[model samples]
Target: MEYQAAPARLSTLDANFEHDFAQRLHWSADTDAAIEQRVADILADVQKRGDAAVLEYTARFDGLQVDGMTALELTQAELKAAFDSLGDEQRDALTAAAQRVRTYHEAQKRASGESWSYRDADGTLLGQKVTPLDRVGIYVPGGKAAYPSSVLMNAIPAHVAGVQEIIMVVPTPRGEKNALVLAAAYVAGVTRGFTIGGAQAVAALAYGTATIPKVDKITGPGNAYVASAKKRVFGTVGIDMIAGPSEILVLADGSTPPDWVAMDLFSQAEHDELAQSILLCPDADYIAAVQREIDRLLPEMPRRAIIAKSLSDRGALILTRDMQEACAISNRIAPEHLEVSSSNPHQWEPLLRHAGAIFLGAYTSESLGDYCAGPNHVLPTSGTARFSSPLGVYDFQKRSSLIEVSEQGAQSLGRIASVLAHGEGLQGHARAAEMRLK
Candidate 1:
C-alpha cells in the first residue's frame, strides 16, 4: 500500500485557505459600508412599515409573490394537521431520527454541574445551576436548500432540554414550505411555525413583530445576508455562530479505496463553490490515485460544476511525512468535518482535539452525520471549530444562576458581601443584602 510521502512543500495550496474556502477568504471580510447602510435602511423601513416592509423585501430578494396573510403565521391546527398528514413511511423515518437525536443529546445534558458546601471558619454553601432557555428561533434555509435535517437538528435538543417555546422559522418561497421541512418540525415538537425567512426573518425574530414574537436566541445556517443579519442582531438576541461554507478534511492511507474518498469529498464540495475538500496522505502514489478518482467522479455528479470549482480552488492533496504529520495538519485546519479513512481510525481518534464532527472508517461518511446519524449538521466552519461547538440544545437554552441562600447562609454571608460592595462604591448593593439579613 504505497501513499504520498511528505510535502516537498505545500506548493499546491496557499496559507490563506484558513480564512475561507476561497484564497481571498471573503467569509471573514468586513461587511461593506454600503451593505451596512442598506441593511440599516431595510431595518428602519421594516420597523416603521411592519409586515408591509418585510413583504416588499421578501419579494425583491426572494422573488416570491408571498401573500400578506400567508407570510404571517401558521395556526396550531395547521401544524398538527401537517403532522397527521405525513405518509406512514415518512412519519416513521422522522420518528426514528428524532429518537436517535434525542438519545445522543440527552446523554450530553449536564445536571447543574457540581454543588459544594464549604466550611471556612463558618459553614456556607455555593454551587452552580444549569437551566434551559424559554424560547429559541431556528432559521431553516429554504428555496434550493430546504433541509429537513436542519429542522430536526435545530429543534430536537431544545425539546430534550426543556425549552418552552421552540419558534421554528423557515422562509417559504411564496408561502410554500417543503413537506420534508414541515415533517421534521412536526417530529421535533415545535409549537409554532412562522413562514418568514432570510434577513427579514432574522430581524423579526430578534426584535419581534405584531405577528411574530421575539426569540431569546437563533440557530441554523443561511446565506451571507442572513449571516450578517445574525451578526448585527447578536446583542439583541443570542446566536449560535456565524457559519461559513462547509468543509471536510480526510486523512486517508492506501488501505482505503480512492473512490470512497472521492465520494466523501463530493458530499461537502457539493454544498457550494466555497465549500472545502482536502486530503492528507503520506504516500505520493495514493494522492495521485485519489486525485484521479475525483476527476472521474466529478463529471458524473449532478452538481459537478460546484464540486470541480471547490476541488480546483480550495482543495489540496497535502503531502505529509507520516500519519502524525497528517494529524498535526488537521489540528491546524480544525475543519468542520474530519474523516479518518486510515486503516486504523482509532489511532488518530485521540489526536482529534478539535473538529465540529468526526467520521471514522470509510463507511462512516460525512453525509450520514449531515442527516440521520443523530448528531447536528449545523457546525462551526471557517476554522471556528478551534473554539466554537456544533449547534445543540444548549444553543437554544439560556441558563441562570439559582441563588437561594438560607437565612442562616445570608446572615453568615452578609458582612463580606456588604464590605465588598462598599469597597466597590456600591453601598446600595451592600444595603440590599445586609438589610435582608437584618
Candidate 2:
C-alpha cells in the first residue's frame, strides 16, 4: 500500500503555540480495557494452574501446541548450537556488543553496586549492603521480531550485578525459533530458556510454575499485552517499568545536513506507528529543508508504512525562537532519546536535562546508542524520563540498610528513639528503646 507522511508544522511565535504544542505532544500510554481484562484473566489462570495455564496460552496465542512444559524448555546445548549456527558476521557482532555492554556495566557496578559501611564518632556502624537479586527474568520479544540486542542489554547488566540466575523467555510462534535470540541467551549466560511468552510467560515468571522458577524481578520490553501484564504483576514481583512507545527529540542548530536529520527521524518512526519523532529548530529554512529530505528519503525505507504512519500522526517539525527555547521545550517533553545535532552540542548540553539518553553531536546517531554504545537501549518512554531512569545494573540489584549501634552510641540514640515513639503513642516501642539504653 502507498503511504504519505506529513509531520505537523508549528512555530513558537504563533498565538496558540502552547495549545498546539500540547496537542502534538500528547500520547496516552493507557491500554484498552478489554486487553487489560484479558491480561488479568490470564494472570489469574496462570497463578492458579501454573504450567498447565502457560502451555494452554502458548498453544492459543503462539500456535505452539504442547502437551507438557518440557516441550517448551530449551536446553543450554540447544542455545549453544544456535550460537554456532550463526554466520560469522552475526556471531562477531553479537560478541562485540555483549562485551561492550558487559564492560560498561562493570564500571557501573564498581561506581554504585558495591557495599559501603562507615563508623560514626560514637562507634555506631551505619551502612548499605548491595546485593543482586537471586534470580531475574529477561523477556525478549520473539516470533515476528527477534531483538538479540535486547538480550544483550538486559542480561549483561543482571549478570554484572551478580544475579545468580538469569532466566530468558521468548515466544516461538508457530514453533519457529530465532537462532540469534537463542545464541544471545547462550552468550549472555542465561541460566534457562523457555519458548513461551505473552502475559502467560510474565505470570509464570512472577508466580512460578512447575517448570519455570519464580524470579525476583522481570526486565525488558514487549507488546501492549506484555506491558499490561508487567503493570499487574509489579507488586507480586519487581518490574523494570511499564514502557511506552519509543521517542526521539532532535534539537538541531542547522549545522547538520537536512537529509541526515530526516533519516534520524525515520530511525525512531520505523519502530512502530505510535513512536514519536520531533524536530526542534530555530531556522525555518532548515526545517523546510529537513521536511523536503524526509519526503525524498522516506520511500526508500523498508518499513515505510510504519514510518509514514508514525511520522504523520505523532511527529512534528517545531520552530523555536532560538536554541535556548528548543532546549526548554525538550526538557518539557522529557523524551526517551534526545539528539543535539548542532555544531556546539556541549553548549546546550547543560540545559537539556530529562532525557533517558543524550546523543551529542551531528555524527552520533541515536541508533548507535541502541546497539553498541555501551549504554542501555531499554529507556524510559512517553515522557517517563522526567521521573524514571534507564535500565541499568542498579535495577537488577537492591540495597539493605546496615545498622549496628555500639553500647556507647545506644544511650544517645535510645533517648531520641524513645522520645519519638512516646510522642507517637506507642508505649511498647518507647520501652523497647529504653530497655536497650541501660
* lDDT tens per residue, model 1, 1-438: 222212112422455434443342334547677777777776667667667777787778767666773545766667667767889987788788888887877866654222333433334445455567878888889888778888889888888878888888888776676777887887787878877777788887888777777888888888777788888889889999988888989998768899998888888888887787888878888888887887677667888877777766666677777888788878878889999997889999998888999999888999888878888888988888999998775665555555556677788688889999999999899999789786
Q: lDDT (CA) for every model shown? A: 0.77, 0.94
In candidate 2, the residue pairs with backbone N, CA or C atoms under 3 Å apart (3 or more residues apart, or in different chains) clash, namely: none
Give the local distance difference test score of model 2.
0.94
Using lDDT as the measure, the top candidate is: 2
What residue runs in model 1 are displaced by over 4 Å at the alpha carbon? 1-29, 80-89, 110-123, 404-438
Worst 10 residues of 2 by lDDT: 1-10
The backbone clash count of each candidate, in order, is: 10, 0
